[model samples]
Target: MQPEIQLSNSTTQLESTQNKVLRNTYMMLGLTMIPTVIGAYMGLNINFAFMAQHPILSLLGMLAVMFGMFMGIAANRNNALGVVLLLGVTFLLGLMLGPILQAALHFNNGAQLIGMAAGGTGAIFLTLSTIATVTKKDFSFLGKFLMVGLVMLILASLANAFFQVPVASLAISAIAIMLFAGYLLYDVSQIVHGGETNYVMATLAIYLDIYNIFVNLLNLLMALSGDRD
Candidate 1:
């Protein structure tokens, strides 16, 4: 009976901890949208002549942004500044997505396709997140696999970007959607199971997953739906 009582208490504490982590992750994830939108607007409206002239600049910019993201994660345990920096990093990512948006906007059905992609991606994310919470299964093992897949995908994308391979582009978009969907599930499960305690880090991971899904979905939709007139 004493052992049973202690087991019940431990279960209750775990549940309480899970609740806090989930709530904080969701709240921080919602807050990240504000800066993302602001950065997108800035990207769409603002033009950088230097960036236009030097494609390498974009590559270097990506490297710098990734460095900042790693730093933010490393600092998340000690300070609130990590949260602020994470938001700023997301804003930078939004800016990077500007050119893609610019290209999509040129299509006759661009706006409609973008809206559909956004809705579809959101629905998938919600479904995956719900599954993670309901099942409470640990998906942390996906981390290494996801990293390897992403690296391969990035290399393929860079090659296709220069080579202009239509099939490659389609493959990347499809793989990206699936990969990020898995990521959504894994990240949410971490929060629900008390594996991820820091809201800032949780938000950053989930935000990147969602953002990649949207980008890939939008690209896929554009390739399929966009009419070249």
Candidate 2:
């Protein structure tokens, strides 16, 4: 009886610790958006002509920088520095949004499209996360598929950068939305199911999922519904 009681207490403590980590992750995720929004607002004013003139080079450069940050975050994942690096990454990504966001605003109903994309992304994030929670299924299974889709996404995006095909661009954006939606499920499920124990890393994963969803959803809406004026 005494051993059983101790085992139960140990299980309860482990659960309590996990809940604390989850809560901290959510808090950090919320904090990250402030810097991201600020960076995006600043990005809106900057000239993106350089990107247009040097599209391929710019894309590769951005990828390199992103990879560096990923490594930095991974190295520091268990520390406060990881949170700092993650926020820095989000800010840089927000700045990168300048080009697309600027393009969206050129359309007649651009503002509406942006709002719709944001709303849709939010809806997906919430719905998928809720499902993961209620079902409590281990979504680590999705990691391999998501990684493959990510590789394909990068290749397609790089190709479209040069080819500039409208149909292909739209298709890529659509695929991206689905891929990141899968990531959202996989990420949130990881947090709930103990596959990921680090809140900092969890927040980073979920944030990227939402970011890609918003960007691609906005692109798709612009393609399908934009009033060219």
Find the candidate with the highest lDDT and give its number: 2
Per-residue alpha-carbon lDDT of model 2 for 1-229, expressed as tens digits?
A: 9999999999898777767777887899889898888888889999999899999999889989999998999899998889889999999998988988899999999889989998999899889988887887878898999999999999999888888999999899999999999999998888887778888888988999999999999999988999986
- Model 2: which ten-residue window has the lowest total lDDT? 14-23
- Could you give the C-alpha RMSD of every candidate to the true structure, in order shown? 1.9, 1.5
Per-model lDDT: 0.83, 0.89
Collision count for each candidate, in order: 0, 0
Worst 10 residues of 1 by lDDT: 48-57
Give the Å shift of residue 28 in candidate 1.
0.8
Residue-wise C-alpha lDDT for candidate 1, range 41-72, written one tens digit per residue: 78887675666676565666778778867676
List TM-scores for all candidates, in order.
Answer: 0.91, 0.94
Candidate 2 global TM-score:
0.94
- Regions of model 1 farther than 4 Å from truth: 48-57
